[model samples]
Target: MTISSAHPETEPKWWKEATVYQIYPASFKDSNNDGWGDMKGIASKLEYIKDLGADAIWISPFYDSPQDDMGYDIANYEKVWPTYGTNEDCFALIDKTHKLGMKFITDLVINHCSSEHEWFKESRSSKTNPKRDWFFWRAPKGYDADGAPIPPNNWRSYFGGSAWTFDETTNEFYLRLFCSTQPDLNWENEDCRKAIYESAVGYWLDHGVDGFRIDVGSLYSKVVGLPDAPVIDKNTKWQASDAFTMNGPRIHEFHQEMNKFMRDRVKDGREIMTVGEMQHASDETKKLYTSASRHELSELFNFSHTDVELPSSAKTWSHLN
Candidate 1:
């Protein structure tokens, strides 16, 4: 049996025809005796990647961070983490990868940022701060039985416990989907969206990054009002349903906005590819997100298979069939 492209008129980009290699920079290789892998190490190993038949290389986050989430929690969008080398090293890596005819992909994490970020710091400083709306901040749902303020909603954190954290200074609750240091961005705010686009996406693309592996892309646009999630189990801690958070109401709208930005910058022969890390989304949502007409993304990273696990008794030594 043979398979063919349904649309032969359209030429497939390098991404569609190429094999991708994902490398977590911290563990890939260490050029210096610095314990952590750096971009210089990656640049030095270009031949190895090329010989491995990888057409593109996607490196995990190496942005300036506190390393709370191992580079996922970004503090400075454009600056490189000092331990991973200077910003010049990163630029050189991109050049080296392109020189080898390999596309360079960087991880784009826009969903949430580290609390140490200037924007977050300003947002959390006071309720009257102009950047306060950049992140999701809301009043409590009134005092509990013991007079303690409850979270705005029953939504639980992705890591664990309540998603909303109370701020004594601001006298309000701020939503953090992941670790306390990683506060979810408010996509509803146009200013916030514009700032993020100009920095995270535009900054990298302008510097010649071939593409992006967007992290937690599906959790960008959450439902309005922050409604309570239905209880899945009485004994369990996390009560929120991903239905409202995973693929929110304006998800496509947000992606389309990003698509337009990318389209305007794309040259005639040079095309950029985007792959979103979509979690807990339905089949229809995935289809819409990756559809060509929708102008959202080129592909998606489906994590359904990651849920597979082995029994505790078989943990000693399990082999794939």
Candidate 2:
């Protein structure tokens, strides 16, 4: 499918006509029989990706990580995991992808890092550590009239239980929106924000990657007040408060900063494409995040379609018909 249009200036071209494929790397194929797929495996399969008519390939995370969250909890944003391949292997894959006239995009998870990550380890070391403020922390809400140690709010974690975990050494609670092993970084901290922005985007740009598919992109920033969420349902183990935390207040500002950085660094006028995965975004919210002038994202994946139960709804559909 050629993407040419008569009025090329006004065309919604490029990606619309490009065939793309997602490689889950781990399950794709194992070249050396190491029981895991590595860069060599992907390199060996480049011919197949090209022959299948894919003009671009979106690779799942292969960054240095603990694999606790399947490579989503990046320990080092600048390097590829040894299990995946060396830096040289990544470059070779890039060369191969480009040789076939196909571009490559990688997954970038910015919301949190593995507990083993240097930033998180140092942040949790002491209350007075310089990096402590790099992550969200709070003193245990001290005392009701009855003198009980209250939590900051009624925020529940996505994995289950409280979102705040107490650190006995520091005598405070650190916020982790997801797994305890994956600590959420404080985007409000300029240093933290700058570090993540540079590391995540710079690595790929340096490696000649075309773009990124930002995982949980909207979950980067949080509301300042950290207020309690009202109860929605008693039967559900999860709380409605999860929504307030997912796409928080300052997310747009963070994205704008990232967008500007990418735009400034683009080589030879090539546009840096970005796709955001936001869990509960509405159509208006999606438009706000992906608006061309806003420079937040090139596109966003909406979760509305997955919320439907087709088989159960078929009876209702029959009645309506």
lDDT by residue (181-245, candidate 1, tens digit) is 88999999999999999899888888889899889888898888888888765765556547678
Q: Give each model a TM-score.
A: 0.91, 0.89
Pairs that clash in candidate 2: none
Off by over 4 Å in 2: 6-10, 142-151, 236-238, 309-321
Q: How does candidate 2 fare on TM-score?
A: 0.89
For residues 100-168, could you state the per-residue lDDT of candidate 2 as single tens digits?
888888888888888889898899899888899898889887757886555667777766677877777
